[model samples]
Target: MLGDIWNATLKGMNDLAGSVGEGAREKSLALIEDWLEIFPQLAEYGLEITSFSMGLAISPSLNVELLGKHEDWSDEAIAKRLADHKGEHSITTVLSTIRTAYRLQKKTQAPLRDPLILKIVVRISPEVRVVLGQPILDD
Candidate 1:
């Protein structure tokens, strides 16, 4: 899934990079290098994001009525989870943040359409954090 997006992002970057200056090309290559370095770190949290998205889809306050339509509830695990009754609370909590003030606005759209790679840990989970933006901005 991420490999597809990574390839597409790189293709777009390379295709659009042709008319740019030497400095710009060098910067883009560096950014891509950084992205290549960081993308592998997100593999550990695979199902969490999907579960999070599913929670968003079922949220009544979020106005997403196409819940079952979006996710195939026919799966044994999903069916069992829904049957359990207690699973909904946990799923919702995992995806939501409570604001202290009366500022909770209606969420008309889903939080993530495509996964954005913002940061990744290099070589180890609790090790160095790197950003894709770092390379482009580096002098």
Candidate 2:
């Protein structure tokens, strides 16, 4: 079961690459690689480091818009869309991509007030009302 899940994750990443484009795909793959290197613990959950791919439906990052932005839709509609999409997109992949983007932007941008800086700050914020009462880090 674990092997199958890992294999699927790799294939999914590859699929996502094809969906985007060569340039974006390669960048996404690199970010996933970095994530794999740091999150050795994910192996226990079936995400093997050796199984990264570019074909997955994985988003390149976690900006809310990247995940799915529908300005006209109500919150309930958005929630439903997310639930439907969750089966196709892995939250782990999104989180990794977002973190990678943040790191890159931090290094490339001058000063701390660049536009990308704000985006990164908002992207990783766990302060949204949904989890406000929960602990930031779970051990």
Q: Pick the candidate with the highest lDDT.
A: 2
Candidate 1 wrong stretches, greater than 4 Å: 1-20, 47-106, 109-139
The deviation in Å at residue 14 for candidate 1 is 22
Estimate candidate 2's RMSD in Å. Answer: 19.1
Model 1: how large is the Cα RMSD against the reference? 20.4
Error of 2 at 132 (Å): 9.0
The digit string of per-residue lDDT tens for model 2 on 95-121 reads 345445445545876333312211111
Q: Please, what are the lDDT tens digits per residue for candidate 1 over residues 1-139?
A: 9999999999989866654545454554443344343223223223221221111111111101111121222235343444553444323221221111012221433232222212221121112221211133532
Tally clashes: model 2.
12
